[model samples]
Target: MEIIQIVGLGLLTTVLVLIIKEQKPMFAFLLTAFTGITIFLFLIGKISSVIQVLEDLALKANINMIFLKTILKIIGIAYIAEFGAQIVRDAGQESIASKIELSGKILIMVMAIPIVSVIIETVVKLLPA
Candidate 1:
């Protein structure tokens, strides 16, 4: 079953990481990164399907599509940035990982500005004199 495959992959990764931990520590680092990315790749399809459902629900609820899409984009960017940062940290590049996280925060704010402006505009329009 799917659970078995998932568990198997995780166990394999853990064992390999342990085995490499004493030898080439850098290989262990790479192994961890590869494992994380592999797991993310497996989940990517499910995430896309869930997003489609969320979009459908938003449409049914008369929610603003642009706002929904913006939120989804922010989620995606955060996930990817976090993954990258973790991988960098696993590779012993803590400083680079922190920089990546900082950049991700800035990018998220930049992406959110338009949505924030739109909300403000809507509020202002509703409060007309």
Candidate 2:
């Protein structure tokens, strides 16, 4: 049902954008951006519920909350960056969209540093001295 709703909205927006693009390209871009944001907002509840389930599983498995939180932040950044890049690309700014994607990858690597360090340390500890 949710997918149907999302697809329907997307199809409708596409038609409207096509119609307005020739007359007012800027307005068409704005409409596309707004619709994308609206869909993202509509799915926030579902996202939160999935996050809650992840948190519950992490707790049950005795995983570190900090690591879980960091991973979640990384995922959030990836999705947001991709979304932003798509919008920019839709507006005909391929260069800017690529920069956005690059920024996201850099941020993800930065955020992953601590986890990587922890794993390396654990591996070192397991090796013979």
Query: Which is the leading candidate under TM-score?
Result: 2
Q: How many Å off is the CA of 115 in candidate 2?
A: 0.2
Residue-by-residue lDDT tens digits, candidate 2, 1-129 = 899999999999999999999999999999999999999999999999999999999999999999999999999999999999999999999999999999999999999999999999999999999
Pairs that collide, model 1: none
* lDDT, candidates in the order shown: 0.90, 0.99
Q: What is the C-alpha RMSD of each candidate to the true structure, in Å?
A: 2.0, 0.6
- Poorest 10 consecutive residues of model 1 by lDDT? 1-10
Alpha-carbon shift of residue 77 in model 2 (angstroms): 0.6
Q: Write the per-residue lDDT of candidate 1 for residues 66-124, one digit (tens) a residue.
A: 88998999998899899899888877789999999999999999999999998899899
Model 1, global lDDT: 0.90
